[model samples]
Target: MDAIQKSMLEKIADLHEVPEGAYNIRSNGALAGRNTTANIDIVTKQDKPGIDIIIKPGTKNESVHIPVILSESGLNDCVYNDFYIGEGADVVIVAGCGIHNCGTDTSEHDGIHTFFIGKNAKVKYIEKHYGEGDGTGEKILNPTTIVHIDEGGYMEMETTQIKGVDSTIRDTQADLKDGASLVIKEKIMTHGNQTAETNFVVNLDGVDSSANVISRSVAKDSSKQVFNSKICGNNKCYGHTECDAILMDNGHVNAVPSLEANDLDASLIHEAAIGKIAGEQLIKLMTLGLTEHEAEEQIINGFMK
Candidate 1:
């Protein structure tokens, strides 16, 4: 691996070597890599910006990793990845994008991922976005995700943007069938003059289907964040959405959570809260011999995790 690739892998996956039985994709024009596994088929489309991953039926305990690295600045990369999960398959995907820019120009990555999960399948998807540079350049990411779950299928998605990203706009939508469920957890922290906005829409279209969307964020040092989530239920289903944020030092946050029920048997709920750090919580940590800064750091870490 080159210096840029190694740095990105370490920061995103924290691995010295790729896993033994996992498929890997590096977005900087490197060839896609995959292990010798019969449970999944990995294919690279000749005319597209992303790969196609198909999990075999009855497969279990499979994992896939897709990470992007950008070594230069003033570059924009857009990718469209698709996943097809077969019936009765259980799989996990770890995907993220990291940029290492040292120039005075901006670098951006726009990724659009779609998933089609078959009946009785389960999928867990996790993605993290990170940017690191010392120059006066901006690192931006715009991600759009769409998920479709068949009857009796389940999907859980987690996305995080810890720091160093200058701006981001994320959009996600999911539709659930009968006896299906969808859960999404989003975590973000921004400092300096960074800004982020996220929107989520989920539809429960069948009986006994459920959807839950949650977001936790921290903004500091003149940063700004906005979160909007809406859930709609069309049948005998359940839905909930929540957004919680912490603001510090001139930071701003706006949260709008909404719910819609078209059927009498549908149930939906939403909650949102944005505030500063609690003084009592900090004082309690300080009494245990931790400095104020350390206490605050600990609390932030715990909260983000």
Candidate 2:
């Protein structure tokens, strides 16, 4: 293992022993190996009222599970495994991966994350994948994640991916119960010749349940990207989905958004768009005597601003 990777594993070596409760894991400067794999398993019981996790890389798989035991509601309100957000409690989870190198050898990676949020509970989730300056070659990864929330619960999830990756398929699922709310935002930026695909699904299953999904992607050079977002609503629920992409140079991006409503009392909306840097806007800034790099930087700052 490289120094950075070793250091990261060492820091969390005792992760299996940490007493759970609002845990945060960060590996901003590490990388997962080209041929490495990881599986994390977490067990969260009511008596513990904490978080659990597993993170290590190499072709090895990792897995984690948080049992959803409701303190009030019965079994009918949540998903399987009693993974509902119980009344008044809160749970937050973040799962991410980093690669140091993906050489010419076609390395493959697959990551799966699953969660069950209890009724009346709140969960804030942030997931990110990053790798920069590694030149191995043809790298592919597929990440699948699931989340379930109960009545009056809240779920917020944000995901990001940056550098050294050729392609990624990310799938996310969430179910909201009565009066529950779910908000998901995904932002991705790709450089060099790469391709990425992202997919998200939100289900509003109860009365007054609300869901929102926002997706954004930035493609540069010869890179390509695709984003698919879907929202479904049940009885008296509300759902909204929006997808937007920015293209630069010879890069290309495709976005598909859809909304489904089973009940007339339910509301749903969906929109998508793909476009390049606004030349008129860039020219206006260039007229100010800014260099090419400065002009490009200004546009990027504006996009993110």
Candidate 3:
């Protein structure tokens, strides 16, 4: 696949072609294409690089597309992907990664993903990360996600990083049981001297377990952003966490949300908001003529959609 790896797979997994049932595509550090159907199964992890996605028992409308692409120069790629959703399954998973560094040294990728969602399973996971060229080296990404949900399980995760990456670190962890439920949504954008970090830890052990975490970020030039969240409720649980950030030139943002409740009908909540970009929303989009950098890029693309 040329044309800069199919335009980095249509900006991370909105593939223009070659997508149906189960799929795996990786470039610059191995396997370029693969497919498996009939209730989905794609294996190849003889104790090494990546791939093992299996969804069988009572599988419904199925889907899987693992996407990773890096364009050679000074490559450092690492991966270990795993997902098993069985009992009463309903599935959809589209993983995404893209990088195309032109020269001068650093282009790194590290991904470790694991999810096992079983009894009464329902899973929807979508991820997107992107980077581009005009190189002078660095475009580094580090991602790690782990989730386990069992009795009456349900999981939903959506993550997006829509900008040329210079450095990123994102890690997520979750565990839930009886009447389990977990949901996470994160969107991030960073500009020039870019650096971003997000970390989340959620544990709602049993008895009507529930969790929700959300983060939205936009930091422009001279960027630096960090958000950390933690939610823990042992039994009879419910948890919530949210962080929102937006900043402009010479931007920097730091947010922390934390919560823990041991029992006694546990319920937890946390929220944070950082400011910038609302001088009457750039004078109401410059009286509908749109100039302040196109009304702050249309309010940061409608607040990252």
| TM-score (C-alpha, index-matched) for candidate 3 | 0.40
lDDT of 2 by residue, 1-305 (tens): 34554432333222333223423332222121111112333333355223334332221112222211111111111111223333555544545554444244544445555555556667676666654334455555566778777668787887766555677888888787789898888878787888888888888888999988887778989998888777887789888888777888888888877778789998888877788777887788889999767888788766653
All candidates: TM-score: 0.96, 0.72, 0.40
> What local lDDT does model 1 show for residue 264?
97
Indicate the residue-level lDDT of 189 in model 1.
Answer: 96
Mind giving the per-residue lDDT tens digits that candidate 3 earns over 228-296? 888889999889888888999888999978888889898898878899987997998899898999899
Q: What order do you get sorting by lDDT, best first?
A: 3, 1, 2
Number of clashes in every candidate structure? Answer: 0, 32, 0
Clashing pairs in 3: none
RMSD in angstroms, all models?
1.4, 11.1, 14.8
List the candidate 2 regions with Cα displacement exceeding 4 Å: 1-3, 6-87, 287-289
What is the lDDT for 66 in model 1? 78
Best by TM-score: 1
